[model samples]
Target: MHLFDKEKIYGDRLLAVDDRDRNVTYDQLDSFSGELYRKVGGKKLIFILCENTIESLSGYLGCLKTGIVPLMLDSHIHPSLLNGLIREYHPAFLYIPKTCIEKIEDSEVIWQFGGYCLCERNEKMPPALYCELSLLLTTSGSTGSPKLVRQSSWNIDANGKSIACYLEIDANERPITTLPMNYTYGLSVFNSHVLMGCTLLLTTYGVLEPDFWGFARKKRATSLAGVPYTYQILKRIGFMDMDLPDLKTMTQAGGKMPPRLHKEFALYAKRTNRKLIVMYGQTEATARMGYLPADKTLEKCGSMGIAIPGGRFWLENEQGNEIIEPDIPGELVYQGKNVTLGYACCKDDLIKQDEWKGVLHTGDIASRDSEGYYYITGRKKRFIKVSGSRVNLDEVERLLKEQYEGIDFACVGTDDNLTIFMDQLILDGGEEIIEYLYQVTGIGNRTAAVKCVDQIPKNESGKTLYKELETTADNRIQSK
Candidate 1:
């Protein structure tokens, strides 16, 4: 099934709402989308550069109906980066919000939807669904440079189905989203709700502000989703104080949450009658693969739960052999329809989809307990073996989060050394945390010593990129 297939199934139902502006009904969505489908019915690619508002969403939904592959570019991106992406993706046509029109002068047609100019209406967009890709997203290039990942129409449908099935979403469920438009986490909320015919409320403009809670309560949201960074901020600001009723489930993903924070939040959610769903996923896997059950909260402190419906997982050794033993660290392999259509190493090439052997190598290291519960030991990149004893920096990061106050951190290792990534103001806290790390693991006995720094590099999903951090240090010292 395709993105449009969901709309066709739930057509004339409430597809979306824009309470901040005027309410948009299903008939309105159908009329506007049909009009858009009529207009851009032949472009191989259509670039949309709009903000996280109603217009952007309408254009996004319209892309589904048109079967014109939507290539999304963040409105806040640098002009040079935007130009680079445009040249690389080479979208035959472009749509920009009126606020961003003047930034592009060389495009073939800069049709301004949502208050922008009508640059071109010439290209014919195709209407085939099965073979088409729904949206093209890139890894947050903050890791160095962005690489494009193509998600087929089926991949999105499967992701929505998996999320809804695991979350136990029903027609009465309402999900609130504060995630940005260009990110997978945000897209999942929109896609899943659309598929389930559930109402999705949007009030992320000034998140963490006092007003957001008022809106949350007013919306009577049964579900909320956030990243580790988002949850960190919420905990800092006191999420428990809001005490939302009618909240059925809240999900955490993007990066691992600190164990202490995980426990506290789980407890807090219990008190507030919310189920904190700790989930594991990447953009490549369509959004999620594993999610912990609410009842299993705190019982399996660091586990990321088991695979969702329509998916299977297993741990594989270095030689790519699946291991059946419990608690054996190996690469996480996912097999399912939700896996991505491969990723491009660069902006110019499209990497075709293929399961290595059969399952996708998730680049994460994990092990299952005797009870069949899975736990992430660390990222494959975060492991530093010093004299045969493998050191998982995620363990260090978790310890730091517990020991240090008001600081979330990353731990990276290279050349037989480990460095802590904390904010500039938290250097002293990092030093204290490192002292505790040495006490816990006796790192001094290992091949290398621990170091602390003002900042540790991370990707858009808040994932620590140890490889880039190591290279960044190398380049800085070499240039000096």
Candidate 2:
């Protein structure tokens, strides 16, 4: 039986609840899934513009129930980017907000409900997808990247079960949404909770919004999940002062939390007798690969903890030999059923089989303690996490160089902050350039900055000196 089969859900349990007080039970959701199945017909692939709403959840669950591969995208995805993906993948159907209907061309709406519409493409031929291909997710969240992680049913099921097992999730737990469902971390929370028949408290309001807390309190939310940025906002807003007696669990993932912030939350969790789980994961692993047990939160403040159920982690040095000594940094490698099939950049790639098997080279450099706890020290890839979304520095430079011809661009910075050094001549266009970066990368001014340099530092080999640029960026941040 499918992992999400209705028979597996607890009988008559509320499946989801929204900020507007709308609720649906498992039976009701199943009925809606049947309706969606009839409308979708033989279509094997769908593009779903996701929101934290009952309609969006229904459509996603329906897709899973009927064996349709759904590529979840941010509901507010830029039009040109979404159109480019539509042209590239040629999805047979689209489940999108009703307001977005005008944005899609040559599509006819077949069904409408709860501010969303299901549209069938006018010119469509179902791509020959691999039988195990269950879902596609953007590699870079909100970056409008066409490259997608190909996840099989086993990947999702294994990861979801592992998360549920480690978190001790039960039917009575209620998890409030704090991140966009399209992101891997958020999707994992959604899928794992649904697996255990928990009432999902859905809201688009962020942690900064007062209404979000009000909704959480009113609904007696049992848990909350967030990224480092979300926890930063929570700390700024005096999360410790809040009186949320019902909230028993909190989870942090999607990027490392600063050491100081991790300590603060760990202390708060300890004082309040609530569980705070620090986790590590990637889209390539479906979702979670490791999670620190809540009991050890304060004891191992900076650690990402041990591997989740059904997963194992080890460190590999430059020579591909496993590191046996503690506190020796190496590329972290994970072996688990959750490891995804591979990536797909186009429709033709969807037919490919599992290229990764059950092992993943995480590209993250980390070390383990004597107690077997893992701590991330650096990243081997030229990527940074901005607001929990992975941003490729090379891709950012390429985009800028392509848009502004003749300008030399070098991008460097730490998590949540990206500095772009450009040719001094474009100093006058800094505002426009930053706005363009936001449009393409979904990185706002708060997280991204532009600095004009006389020339991009390069060596005799003509390769940009990123380390030197990083030092320069560090000095600038410190001076500020």
The candidate maximizing lDDT is 2
TM-score result, candidate 2: 0.82
Angstrom error of the Cα, residue 276, model 2: value is 0.6
- Which residue pairs in model 2 clash with each other? none
TM-score of 1: 0.87
Model 1 lDDT-worst window of ten: 471-480
Residue 5, candidate 2: how far off, in angstroms? Answer: 4.1
The TM-score values for the models, in the order shown, are: 0.87, 0.82
- Which lDDT value does model 1 have at 221? 74
- The superposed Cα distance between candidate 2 and the true structure at residue 208, in angstroms, equals 1.2
- The number of clashing residue pairs in model 1 is 10
lDDT to native, each model:
0.69, 0.85
Q: Using TM-score, give the best candidate's number.
A: 1
lDDT of 1 by residue, 66-162 (tens): 6667767676667777767655545566677776766665655434454544345243432232244667777763322458667877788889888
Q: What are the runs in model 1 whose C-alpha is more than 4 Å off?
A: 1-13, 108-112, 115-130, 141-146, 345-358, 385-389, 424-431, 445-460, 464-480
Candidate 1 global lDDT: 0.69
